[model samples]
Target: MKKKRIYISEAHKGGRELFYIQEVFKDNWIATEGPNIVGFESDLENYLQEEVHVGALNSGTAALHLGLILLGVKSGDEVICQTMTFSASANPIVYLGATPIFIDSEVETLNMCPVALEKAIVHRILLGKKPKAIIAVHLYGMPFRVDEIRAISCKYEIPILEDSAEALGSSYKGKKCGTLGEIGILSFNGNKIITTSGGGVIVTKTLEQKSKAIFLATQARDEAPHYQHSQIGYNYRMSNICAGIGRGQMEVLDNHVILRREMHDFYVNLFENIDGVLVFNEPSADFFSNFWLTAILVDETKNGGITREILRAALEAENIESRPLWKPMHLQPVFEGYPYYGAKVAETLFENGLCLPSGSNLSDEDRERISKTIQVVFKKEIKNS
Candidate 1:
């Protein structure tokens, strides 16, 4: 019999998840408003230290769009975003008809480069248009250089939109990732640490921001009994059913973080002795990564010219799923015309990086099979060299 295929990430839903969903159905509260939605938001607020108000939304993209709206980003304004992140980080910029100025990543954290960001800010200022906000992401659950990024934002007097979509359980200096910026976004997509099936939240520091986000997300309904509208709005509220899933998922969130860290350790141990393999890890003690998806960089110079693609193909032959790191946004055709700043760090990372199988529920058999395939590829490459 053929072995089971191991994927890079997968949602782990149990009876508890289903039980919550059933409760929502039994109560006939399947729409966007319900006790589950309130409970989930409260749970997140407490878990994240209550420093920020949380607004449940349909997806992380919705959270980002609302965050930009809160930041006063509008048509013709420019927003500085980390180029090495998922496109969602930049797509919201275009959603508001604002341009995104892509900043490259640093090699250590594979996140926004502080120096490049400052350079971009100054360059934009000289062009007579100061960027309205900065969108820095915690890529792959690894926190960016929070201190440095915050300092730069403060110096420039620019607000930050922290995209913690893949970093809900991650932290920097003991503070949660999603609470670091003026406004933060989280994703509960099936692939994230805690799956709401599909949902997200926008986090902010004040009631006004929270209320405004809620208003804007719910079609900007004015205070009236009948249908009313005073401004533009969106249909981005999370369904109560989905919020129930989120509530249940929150119950096991800490456990999920622990399992993800264990997976990271496993990859670290497996690749420690491999000459050309470099596991992507927390840059320092200050950064606590959730290790959402364990990734590695294969240095061809040290690996006798063997490339990441070669190993990716070998793993594919064994029915193991992996993926190349996100290509820098500046390289994407849709974002090509935008301005970009920094050296080739992000470009190099894209050239050699690959995500490994890192599902929190992966079995020992899955690990052994994956490890064996990788070992075989490296062994053959060494032999050929």
Candidate 2:
């Protein structure tokens, strides 16, 4: 008999999702504005606990676009972004007709390298286009080098657009990831720690910025009985129904984080004796990751020619799902020809990294299957030796 397929990351619904969703139906508050939306935002604010205001949007990409606007990234401007992130991190720069200068990742955090970032800022300044903002991401729930990156941001006087889309539960040095930057964003997409179905939020330092983001997100309507517009806008507000799901998910967010971290531990223990496989982990005591997805780097030389792809195939044969790490934006065809700083660090990570199954709802049977599949692959290496 064929085994069930295991996904890399999947949404796990808590018991209360239906309760909040039903409240929306009962009240006929089916539109974008409703009690659930307000309650959901409040829950996030309290959980984040930094006095930051949040404006819910249709997607994390929308949040990024609004974040750039709030940071004053206008046409013909230049913005610096981490290359080792999802395209959403860079797409907003293009949305505003600004250019993105890609920076490479460091080996330690697999995030923006401060050295490369400083170099990019200086070089861009020399070219007569000072960057308006910096986009730094907490990749796969691992907080970036927050102190180093923030210092660079201060020295260059460029505000950071923190992409905490994958880091809702991650923290650095006692502060939440989203609260570290001048402006931040969180994703509640279906695959994230908490799902708003398909929603995100832009975290601002003040209520005024949050109000402005909501105004822009809701088509920038002027205050009048008749429809009037002072500037351009977008239809980006999250629906009340989706926020209902978020409200329920928020009820169990911490538990989900715990489960995901336990999965990371599972992989760490699984690979402890397996040669050539290094699980991606927090570098030091200062960082706390959600372990949204547990990833590993495969060293083919030490594994007797077993590469990431080969191991991925081994899992696939057993009806499991796995994926490669993000190919750095600098290497993507659409993003090629853009100004890129730093060396082949991002490239090397892309070549060797693989994301494993890390859903919070995985059962003991599922883990046994995954463990058995991986063990079979390494056992071959031992036999070859």
Best by lDDT: 2
For candidate 2, write residues 1-385 as lDDT tens digits. 8877899998998749999999999999999999989999899899998989989899999999999999999999999999999999999899899999999999878999999999999989998899999999999999999999999999989999999999999999989988999999999888998898899999999999999999999999999999999999999999999999999999999999999999999988888877799999999999999999998999999978899999999999999999888999999998889999999999999999999999999999999888888878888332110
User: In model 1, how large is the Cα lDDT of residue 375?
Assistant: 79
Worst 10 residues of 1 by lDDT: 376-385
Runs of candidate 1 exceeding 4 Å displacement: 380-385
Candidate 2 global TM-score: 0.98
TM-score, model 1 to reference = 0.97
Which parts of model 2 are misplaced by more than 4 Å?
380-385
Q: After superposition, how far is residue 87 of candidate 1 from its true place, in Å?
A: 0.7
**lDDT of candidate 2?**
0.93
